[model samples]
Target: MTAPEDHDYDVIISGASVAGSAAAIMLARRGARVALLERRSDPAAHKVLCTHYLQPCSYPVLDELGLVPALEKAGAVRNEARWYTRWGWIEPKAAPSGPELPYAYNIRRSTLDPMIRSHASGTPGVDLLAGHAVTGVIREAGRTVGVHATGPDGPTELRARLVVGADGKDSPVARFAGIPAKSHENERFSYFAHFRNLPLRDGITHSWFLEPDVAYAMPNDDGVTVVAVIPDKKRLPAFREDLEGAYLDFVRALPDGPAIDAAERITKITGTVNYPLHSRRAGAPGVALIGDAALTSDPLWGVGVGWALQSAQWLAEAVAPALTGRGDVDRALTAYARRHRRGLAGHQHLAADYAKARPFNPFERLMFSAAARDAGMARHMHLFASRIIGPLRFLNPVALARASAVNLRHRGGPSPAPVHLPHPTP
Candidate 1:
């Protein structure tokens, strides 16, 4: 097949979401030709369903990509995160006394996704093809060599040395490549939306831990707030009937009532039921997956967007040498997989542990109880909650001992019962 003129890209990325766009930006900036394909025709089209919360660690990559300024101009809000348990609110602690960390940003996916996509499309050596869907990967003797796609015109083919699957949770490229995905099912579903007029706590992303149920109220730019209700999957059917009302009720059940009361629902309530968090081994031969297509963690932690961007960065760094012919592609891909696994496997493992409907461990109990009583503890708890610290830090013998002593003293017993915090208002 003859390559399309002005369309012979070094890489063809399927799914023009955050990961794909970010990869395109990175590859194109390095002078590698890239073609980003999206099924949607509108360049301005956005993903409205995302929670839109990104961790502070992701800021470095955004800055490196020169996207922080653009994101700021796009009305993204910089905010610290707060964890609410039955014990109390764990607010961001002051530096020196606590873990020094950066604050995260809450931007509407509707705004952020498009901004990244637009910037990527404008980069030199990058071609953006909207309304195009990749049908299959073209392979030569077992190596991914190109892509066959259906575009605005009839059938079209584009050749590339590498093919990236950024098509999200159910990526067709991942399926076509025969990569197996292992998923852990949870007894929960998520209902989310954007609202205006909600009285939000300034500079803080709030999460309320209602046992077996979770709710979050994130304040974004432009007086907009995003709220989500994660209810047990059994209750999912009822939510399907009246998503908005169900979400509202779930929020109202929280200790401080629904946080979204001040804000009017500007968008319809959307719901996803029995959504399983899946993690797949990311690389095989000439193909690799990034973002949700690679690994999906529990949304309760708000790690999706940050992980997506971080994974894209990792993939680029891992493969750039190979793309430039300095290393073996297979070796580079293996190294990339190893790096990806090492970076997130711990976090995902912790998330999966918490995903189970089980009582909080001693450390969690202590941390929450202490955060309720001591401002110092609150800061530490915030750091861990922000994912600035690994689970091992919290579960260390010293920390665990402190938590046990605190719990015993507070509860007046050796074993303190798990405290059930009310869900926050959405």
Candidate 2:
């Protein structure tokens, strides 16, 4: 039955994944009623096509939600990220390591999603409608007011003052609200699996960029390493012909890899043969988008999880006044859109550029070469890689000067750091 013209919730968020759940918790904490609709009813159902590495940038948001303690208690590891370039590992020198959320969490999405959803469901003003599939958006005078969905029993119309699409890359809510995302050529396809007994740094996450091709061996909470490879589309034929062999060959070729080759895969080798990259403006009248619905960058960088939770928090802060009727909703939506662009547009542009599967640009050559030679430069760059700061700040004059000096110091010679992969932690 139709729930009439007025809204039953202050916000109706489609998709109860990371972005949706985070927003639900934030809004409910602010005294706004939220309806979190999830198509899958099972508490254990999870997003399988993900590496699920949350960058350090997401730590503050997790802390605000009081989730870090819980996640750590559940075996989440806090490790600094280290990258392998053609030269050597561009490892950051240790900063004054206090309890300042210095490391990132690598957990299975199957586990991470359920934990987040459980908290959102338990929040005071949140109504979690499990198994409710959003089918359409309800409109009045050309403004989005809510969503129409089918529950377990029958069709239902759920209205709200604001609608958020967090349903992923191909968001139905974004489509129904007529918010189009700008998509670009996707030059890569990826495959990954969780494996047992893979050698890992107890406190260091690893990424090896063999330029156009990238690989990862990350230690997750359950004592398994999530090994993944993103190869250019030109390699698709080989992957399709022999996914297992091709996948192993790619990972084996990483500068810091082949460790995953020895470990036994505990889960099926799962992945997307062709994953497209999409970027949306993410805000409109009475509606907004978060997570992949807002902007899906190349998975090679693994920014999705952090960005998902971060975007939700950003939107909640921007729209809190509007949801509570203290400020104009239209202005609030515009503010959210502006902040979204401010936060991600530069980062997304570079992500799209790299997704082209081309060799490093001159800027990258300077940056990587510099980062490899100089620890100070590498630490500053880490601010960018772990997403603590955006591109512009990372590329400031201080970093550029160090890179120039490093290039001159070697006079074009390659820079490879001292050997040190940590012994396994007890």
On lDDT, the candidate that comes out on top is 2
Q: Summarize candidate 1's per-residue lDDT along 222-313 as a digit string, tens digits.
A: 77888887765656666667666667777776666455565688887786776678999888887889999999888878888888888889
* TM-score versus the correct structure, for each prediction: 0.90, 0.93
Show the colliding residue pairs in model 2.
none
Q: Pull out the clashing pairs in model 1.
A: 187-233, 196-263, 197-262, 197-263, 198-262, 198-263, 254-423, 258-425, 259-425
lDDT of each: 0.77, 0.83
lDDT value, residue 385 of candidate 2: 82
The predictions' CA RMSDs to the true structure, in order, are: 3.5, 4.8
- Backbone collision count in every prediction? 9, 0
Cα deviation of 37, candidate 1, in Å: 1.3
